[model samples]
Target: MKLIKLDAIDSTNDFLKGLSVTQELENFTVVSAENQTKGRGQMGAVWNTEASKNLIMSVFVKDFVLNPNGIYQLNIATALAIIQVLKTFNIKDLSIKWPNDIMSANFKLGGILIENTFKSGGRISSVIGIGLNVNQTNFDNLPKASSMAVVADTVFDKEKILVLIVERLKANLALINTNSQGLWNEYLSILFKKGVPMPFKVKEKSFMGIITSVSAAGKLVVSLEDNSFVEFEVKEVQMLY
Candidate 1:
């Protein structure tokens, strides 16, 4: 794997996207930065982090899954990879909030954002940007934010954690082509709030529901009141705490 270390940038995903278009890059090529001025999250949300205190990186992956319908496999495989890495480091109570927010006991520990590039020949490549709080200790006003240092009571080597996560991603993504169902099952087992009653909001309505399972297309499947079931795409519904 080729690694590029930058002092800082606007967004690692944007940098990787620029590189992928400007020149040929090998699969598993990585770009890491010490800070980001315009870090992004799912659905255009801003990713806020303390400078040089977290793992900010993007990875280029190619020739994995060509089927557009199977894109959610990338998310499942990626989430499991990070969860597994944290497990090895003795980070406890890890769970994935719907889609791909990494959580530990209700606190946000990391996140994953994947952007894909498509070619007319049915080939696809992805730039996966991962942000994990490593040594940062102060969250200030971010109530749900926490870090490995706070959760595990020790400082961490951010580079080593990045290497482990990338290695696991490579292995997990390789299995997705044939063992997607297996991966999906594994993802569901650790899914946050599964089988528990929770409140949700849709457009202008509010209701209580239970998160049952995720659809193959990555929609959150909820069992609502009155014995009804509904599926919601990401950002279509908000889970109210």
Candidate 2:
């Protein structure tokens, strides 16, 4: 894997996208920044992290041959890879909040944002942007945020953690090539609030529902109070605390 370490950048994903347009990039190439000035999150939310205090990086997956119809498989693979890496550190209560937000207990530890470049036929490449709270101890107003250091009661080498995650991602990609079914099953097993009735807000309406499973297209499948199942794409509904 080729790794590019930047001192600072607007966004690692943007940098990787720029690189892709300017020159050819190898598969599994990684770009990490000590400071990401314009770090982003799912649905255009800002990923706020103190400079050099968290893992702000993007991985380029080039020429991956997986069918675009099962793009959620990529989401499953990425989430599981991060979870596996955190498990090595003995982090407890790890769960993937719908789609791919990494949570420990009730607090969020990290998140995954994947952007795919597609040809007319199928997906060509992808840039996976991940932001994990590492050494950042204070969330200030963001009550749900927590870091690996705070959760583990010890400091960690950010670079070492990033490397481990990348390695696991490569391994998971290999597994995807061989066992997509296994990866999908494992992802569902670790889903947050699965089988538990939880409050959700659908636009202006609020209701309780249980997360049954995610669709192949990455929609959240929820079994509601009326015994009917509804599928919601990202941001269509909010998982309420």
Candidate 3:
């Protein structure tokens, strides 16, 4: 549970990744920054957060050892951990959007970015970066964004939320290590838009589709109007808001 706190940095993910290259980081080692100048999000988008307000951190999981084919378990575990903590705050309409974005109703409350490193003999280490909107309520420019304070109508202590998330993450990781099958089912149970027809776009074409399930490899499984199920990798399709 070694934690490194920084006043500011470019990206916590990059910082931990750089350290993992030259050093053997312990499991649950965390690097958190008060402000990230170039915070990264999924699909290379920049994550914007007010200074010293949100949770900007990266966690190191050593000796993950899980099969590469089951990497989605990592996403499931991380997302569920965040959802559990948000539930304690009584945040309404909590859901995990595909590939691990925490959402309240339709607004994004947090996101996860996981980077895995493979070593010899099938060992894996994961550097998981998480960005959660905590107390920052202003999102006029970003219509899809919301924070714990905004949705719950109460200000939250960012550090307290960080500690709770890390604790829950460790617990979730332990559960997945033993009962991945059960955890997978729980993830699907709380998945957003599951079995509901939603708008999506693929290559400038829009269509309505129902999300059936996610593949073990983390592909989105969508059932279209033609009753054909299609699996799509991230970036191959976009879930329309």
lDDT at position 69, candidate 3: 85
Please give, for residues 1-241, the per-residue lDDT of candidate 1 as tens digits: 8999999999999999999998999999999999999999999989998999999999999889879999889999999999999999999999999989999988999899999988889999999999999999999999989999999999999999999999999999989877888899999999988999999999999999999999988999999888999999888998886
Q: Which stretches of candidate 3 lie over 4 Å from their true place?
A: none
Question: Please, what is the whole-model Cα lDDT of each candidate in the order they appear?
Answer: 0.94, 0.90, 0.90
Q: What are the candidates' C-alpha RMSDs?
A: 0.8, 1.1, 1.0
Worst 10 residues of 3 by lDDT: 62-71
Better of 1 and 3 by TM-score: 1
Quote the lDDT for 59 in model 1: 96
Compared with the true structure, what per-residue lDDT tens digits does model 2 show for residues 1-241? 8999999999999999999988988888899999988988889989878998999989999555468786777788889999999999999899999889999999999998999898676657899999999899988898999989899998889998889999988888888778888998899999999999889998899999999999988999999899999999998999887
**TM-score: model 1 vs. ground truth:** 0.98
Point out where model 2 deviates above 4 Å.
Answer: 120-123
- Of the candidates shown, which would achieve the greatest lDDT relative to the real structure? 1
Specify the highest-TM-score model's number: 1
**Which ten residues in a row are the worst by lDDT in model 2?**
62-71
Where model 1 places Cα greater than 4 Å from the true spot, the runs are none
